[model samples]
Target chain A: MLSMQKVSFRYGKNTDYVLSGVDADFVPGKFYTVFGPSGSGKTTCLSLLGGLDTPTAGEVLLDGISLRQIGGEELRRKHVSYIFQNYMLFPYMSAVQNVVTAIEISGKGGREAKQEAEKVLLSLGIEEKDMYRKVRKLSGGQQQRVAIARSVATGSRYILADEPTGNLDKKNAQMIIDIFLRLVREQEKCLVVVTHSQQVRDASDIRYELTDGQLSLWGEAAEYAEF
Target chain B: MRNFSTIAKRAFRTISGKWKGYALLLLVVAAITLTLYIFFFWLDASARLATQARTSTEACILLQSNDRQQIGSLPQAMREHPAVKGSDTTTLLTASPVNFVNAVSRQDSPFDLPGESDQVLVSAHTDIAMSDAFRTGNASLVEGAFPTGSDPQVVIEDVLAKRNGLQIGDSISMSLSLPGYTEPHQLNLRVCGIYHLQQPIEATYYTSDGTPVYGASPYSSVFVPFDTLAVRFPDALSQDSVCFYLTDFTAISSVLEQFRQLNPDPARYTLSDFTDYRYEQLLQASQAVGRLILAAVWIFIGMELLILFFAILSILRSYYKDAGILIALGERRRCVAAQFLFQILVVGVVAVSVTLVGAFLLTPLLATLASGQIVHTAAETLPGNAVEIGAIENMARLLEEHGGNFAMLYASIAVLSVLVLLGLSSFFLFSHTPTRRLFDKE
Candidate 1:
């Protein structure tokens, strides 16, 4: 479980906070989404949860271990994986090679890593022809699928995605939503996604709204009381 | 842990993708290396030539033999010594060449002596002295012949003979003036030959009267056989100096050392050889030229390094995004550094190999240009008959023997500079570009 305990953040020496007094908990077999408009610190929250940044105040804990103590690079490499909206694949590499490289970085064996990379790419609706083509030559939907494959290939328990389907069309976004739901429900993985799309927010198991550096649970007392 | 295979694969692909940049870098490095090689060859050749020129010249050794032990046997000793080519002996006196010429003409106070100096009178007694005289075109027997021995006969240079108007068979009287002697001792001799010389053998010294005088050339002096002079002034004819010419010029120092061991007292016996001194002078001149070449070589190398530094920096700057991506993917900083280093090492090794071939072809052209200068400078100080070409060729052979060091240094510099570039590139990655900014762009 990754949790944010009374977490607050500010950029540099500014007086106003980008995120303040925020509390959140993420667990396996559960899908979490933070939805808000621009300037709502939605991506900032994902950045902290992904271990790409540290909160200026309060602590972010991973399985009762501090994210600050584990170090961002180590935590990201071993426990959490991030996916960006733009799909930051290496332009020079093919879709399969991109997946393979990510898995290798996550410490998989060479032969097994390549096998897993191909398996994930094929499952994500990437054809054999497109799987071997350079990422730059791949279409937007195919590139986003490759990025999803890369995130899943790492096998990290927590996936912190900042608007994973922001650049995808309806059908591709729906497919990505299915993949995320299956990962959370079947694979028993915790996924924290930040998005403004209602379909994605409704597909998630729990929802929170962030506005002006403040976070609030959105469901009614009985409907969300189990949390 | 880094997956080295991935880094290597990526490095190769990156190089292939940017082949033009790597090619340009290789050419620049090869050109710089070629320049260094040319200078090394030229400087080495010039230095060897200068050393040979100075050491191969004629050497003169001065020695004092108060007792006739060493002096009497000097001619034979010099002739038998393996290093000696030729030798001659001379004696100085306070007697008069003018008085002798005046006596031969049967006239007193008729004209001023033409070849006379107000210095101590000096004459040499050697049969082979004519070898130097005739070979130099300085003198030849114009009338009659050279004396067979110290047979009471004299050969006078043409200038002295002309002023006195003396015939070849005319008898002359020479007198020696000693400070404590009751009367002047004299010897009567007949003139055997009269030779003309453009430049003559001259010696300078002070007379018993303490009058300083500069000596005149041998063309203005008298010469005779040693036995007759010894008979006439037995007490005055001690051999004070002997000069030896060596067959091998390089053996001069060792022979001089042997002479020192023979005569150890510095005050009573003074010795000097010009070979070592001349060698030092030539070495200093050559070293000055070599220093200039070294300076130019280093300046070019420094310029090449600056170009390399900026070129690598530019490449790294363009690859910042890639490096940041790698960092975000959980690649260690050292892994990123190694990836960059591998690429640089590949380029550097290829460039150095190309330079080796280029330098091999270019060295001969540079050496030929320098050999002409080597010969010309040698001719300036060496005798006219000396073989300047042979000395230069010998220097070339010597360079061939010692050429490996420069080639090694060339390779070493290429490798070391590449390592430095890699280190700087790694530092640039760690300190100049940040991974957080890479993800923020999305």
Candidate 2:
């Protein structure tokens, strides 16, 4: 389990807090989403969860141990993986190579790593032919699938995604949500997604809303009521 | 946790994918290398020439003594001097009778033949074959060999041999007039060798009617073994001169002072300073030029390194997005830095290899070009001496020896420059910036 305890964050000393007193719990075998307005710190919350940034005032812990004690790099490498909105695959590498690179970075490398990467990509609906093409040459849907496959191939327990289906079409977005549901139901992996899509929120098991540096359960929030 | 081969493969891929940028860097590094190599070659050649010109026999001093005992002892004394590298002694023989049988005669002959017949009068004002004149390249042996040891042998001039149809192993008779002897001592000597003067001596003789007749043909006297001459004419009047080669030309004044301490009387022991001031000035000028070239090479290296730093910085900056992606994929920051460093090193090694091969292939041509320029300048400004020209000719060999050292130096500097650039860029780009900010599209 990964949880945030009264976490607060600001860009710098002079800047106002982007996330204040934020609290959340993520467990395996569940898919969750955080929705908010443009400046509601949804991405900042995901960054903290993924160990990309440190909390200002509180603790982000994995299995009751503080992230600082676990070390950010080790936590990210062994416990969590992130998927960005832009499908931030290495532009020069093919889809399979990107997943293999992620696997290599996670310290699970060898000739077997390539077979594992191909298996993961094929399971994610990427064809064998498209897997060898440079990511830039792949479609938006295919590139997002490659990014998700990279997260899955690393075998991290928690997959933190920021707007995973933001650039895909409606049909492609639905397909990605289905893939996330299958990952949670079949692989028993935790999925924490920061998104504003109604399709993603409907597919998730639980939802949270971030507003004015605060996070609250979706149905109980005043913003959700207004929406 | 990436291994070296994995990181190197990624670096190689990145370099090949972005070859245009790396190619530009390679060209810049190659240009700097070529410029630096040319300057190094010039400095090396100039320094060697300067040293050669400085220590040559042109910087020697001559010590002449008319005192018979002092003349005999001054050579051994000068040879034992600490400052002297070597010494050569010459004894000028005068009015020795030389008779040639059945010789050819010309109208402009300086020698008065008997009754205009084929008998030639040869006045052998000879010196030793190993005298200062021959040692200094004033004359060279054309046929046979120099008289070695005391063999009662002589090497006549080429013109004298040609005029008299003389061949080697022919007998020549000379009489030395010893002091307090009514009769001259006759000695029969064999012609063992012949030599030609580098610069022929002009002859002016008076006819019987007091008209001066100039000879169109050049003439020079004979050479004999000094030991034989000294043994045969023990009491003959001889002017003795000693040439002293100093170990250090800069200490010529001190060496001259040492010589004066040995022979204090100026009238009996006259010192002729034959040190070539022009050659010394040229040496100084060459040294100054060498220093200037070295300075320019260093400045060029400094400026090129600055350019390299910025070039690598720009390259790293362009790769910031890729680095962020790698880091976000859980790659260690140090691994990313190593990958980038490997990329730069790959390009650097290729550039250095290309430059070295190019330089190796072109060294002989460059050396020839440099030698030609130095030889032309030396011939114009310096005397036509064999030692100076030989030194100029040695530039090719020196360049070959120094070229290897220069290549090694260039390789070291190039690799060090690349490493420094990588270090500075990594510090600026990776150490100070956050990974999120690096890949942040906005």
Candidate 3:
């Protein structure tokens, strides 16, 4: 679970604000959806939640511990798995290789890491036939699936998906939504899906929309929302 | 702790990935290496030549003058001085017009007086005083046997033998003239044996002037017993002039002072030392080659650094998005720098390994190209013969025998430079490029 209070950020002190006065909370064992217009700071929110940036003002807490207080990259590799909007799969790698990247990044040993990558892809219902194919040859939906598998493979408690279904077709999007809902409910991992897609909003258990720099819960009080 | 294989594997991966880099690096390295080889090989050979020149039994002192009456007193004085390891006195008689039958040009020039060899060599003990005439492997009798038991047998230098249509047991004519005489007086002597010398001095020979002459020559050395030479023309040797030889080769100036006080003729006589010998000249020439090698090495290494830095920068730019993603994923600046650092090491190891293997493999072929023998010659000191293509092979062999010292020094320097390269690359990475390098971090 992650929580943020009055989180405001500007790229530089004198530059116009990129995010400002944002207060939000992300709960574990829940599928949380983040929706916003373009430049609405949803990406910034997700990055903050995953410990990618320092807010100009406000605090972000993960499992009651502030993400800002931890040592940077190692902590992220240890606790958070991120899926970028454009699906940042390791390009020279295969589908399984993409999944194994996170494991290697986390400094887990190799033989066991590959097995772990296989387990994640298998659980996502990606076929073994496509596992060895390089990521560039795979379809966008397949690439997104590989990214999701990598995020899951590391067994991190937090999953920050930046527009996970943004580039997918309706069928792939619905399938991905279903996978998130199942992982959040059963595995009890924090799944924060940042997207503006109405279908993702419609399927999520809770939704928060970022307007300007602030987030407001628009749901039926999926409230335990503010820590 | 990983030995050869692990390092080699890492090197192989980098080479396979960046074939052009490997090729460019090797091209420059090979050219530089060959240049260094020529240089270092010369140095090694010349260095060995120095030691051999120092260690060999050579003429330590030679005194030449035209006056036989005054120099005859040299034996008594020289024998009294300490540090007289050994001494050899020879009578070098000069004249003109040998008058050989079927001769190329009945040249009336030096070496017309064929002096007695034993009288010329009688100053020192035969065991120690005998000049190293030539390598014995090249000595064999084509007609009769070598001159034995002082039977008045004569041997001529190979050039003289080839010049005149003379055979063993054949007779030859010679002449000797004094200052008072306008024309040379002639005498005939029988030839007995022929020999060649390893020394590259001008091919010359000697003779019996009106007075016995003591010296060396090209096509000019003739041997006769001291008794035979004395019976024919007896005279004491001249020693009015003086050339100095100190106990140590380096003390020429101080020893020159001593020789001046002892013999007192500075104009005609001069101090001779190691530097004046054939050895030092070869060494200087080799060092000149080494300087060229050192310059080439510096240029090559500088080029390598420039190329490597630019190449790495381009690679980093190509992966700008990757850097952004890593930064967004919370990778610290240090980790990003380390990855690139590892990448360059991978390349360095591959390139260096290829060079080492290629150098070792091609070394023998290079050696073959440089096949000159280690023939020590007096002409190594003479002008027009300091270095030449004809003797490069011999020079190379001598260089090879002494190259281990140079190799150790060069390799150590190379390794140190590589380490410094690592530090410089890392410094460049850390100080010049930060992980927040690209503006598009999302």
Candidate 2 docking band: acceptable
Error of 2 at A13 (Å): 3.7
Tell me the whole-model lDDT of each prediction, alpha carbons only. Answer: 0.67, 0.71, 0.56
- Estimate the overall C-alpha local distance difference test score of candidate 1: 0.67
Cα lDDT of model 2 by residue, A91-199, tens digit: 7788988898888888877798899999999999999999999889999999999999999998998999888888889999998999999999999999999887898
State the weakest 10-residue window (summed lDDT) of model 3 chain A. Answer: A218-227
Over A17-81, each residue of candidate 3 has an lDDT whose tens digit, in order, gives: 77777777777788888887777777777767766667888888776777767745756777787
User: Candidate order by DockQ, highest to lowest?
Assistant: 2, 3, 1
Report the C-alpha lDDT of model 2 over B274-344, residue by residue, as the tens digit. Answer: 56554454464455556656787788788887877677667776678778877777777777887887777
Please state the Cα-based DockQ of model 1 relative to the true two-chain complex.
0.18
Error of 1 at B294 (Å): 5.9
Ranked by TM-score from best down, the candidates are 2, 3, 1
TM-score of 3: 0.65
Instruction: Spell out the clash pairs found in candidate 1.
Output: B83-B247, B138-B197
Q: Can you tell me which runs of candidate 3 are displaced by over 4 Å?
A: A219-227, B1-306, B318-339, B364-391, B401-442
